[model samples]
Target: MAEQNVPIQRMTIIRTLLLFLAWFNQFLSMNGYSPLPFSDQELEVGVSMLVTFVVSIWTWWKNNDITKKARSRTEYLKGKGIM
Candidate 1:
């Protein structure tokens, strides 16, 4: 239970940070100072979509890292007959 909660707690912190970043990005876009500079397309669909895609990929990577770590620990303990 302790080990399980540990990863979950860390993941929660990271998720909150990502949510804050997403909201910050949205606020910038509404105010006309989005990260990607291009006065022509204020409603830059491609740029916004790109950021969203990147965030998705990042989240997927984080989840994968967590899974790999958990698996490695589990396997290590099992190999030593500690599990």
Candidate 2:
């Protein structure tokens, strides 16, 4: 059976928002303005933690999606006696 060429969506709005936040924080610090309550170092650490957490979650979600797709494909092949 021919494989179904479905494209998975890899881009997430949450990640983009996180990236924008980090960039905006840096931009604010560079302009000598502390828009947030935390110090620069503290903000960096906090943002770093957020990034790590988001990345972990995203990785798990993507892996889950891929696994589901693989299982579906496998079952399809088995149904067609192609496995």
- CA lDDT for candidate 2: 0.86
- Kindly list the per-residue Cα lDDT of model 2 for residues 3-83, writing each as its tens digit: 998765557767888899999989998999887888779989999999999999999876663676788987898999997
Q: Residues 4-77, candidate 1, lDDT per residue (tens digit)?
A: 54355788999999999999989988997756565646557777989999999999876663677788987898
Using all chains and alpha carbons, the TM-scores for the candidates as numbered come to: 0.37, 0.46
Best by lDDT: 2
> Global lDDT of each model?
0.81, 0.86
Ten contiguous residues minimizing lDDT sum, candidate 1: 1-10
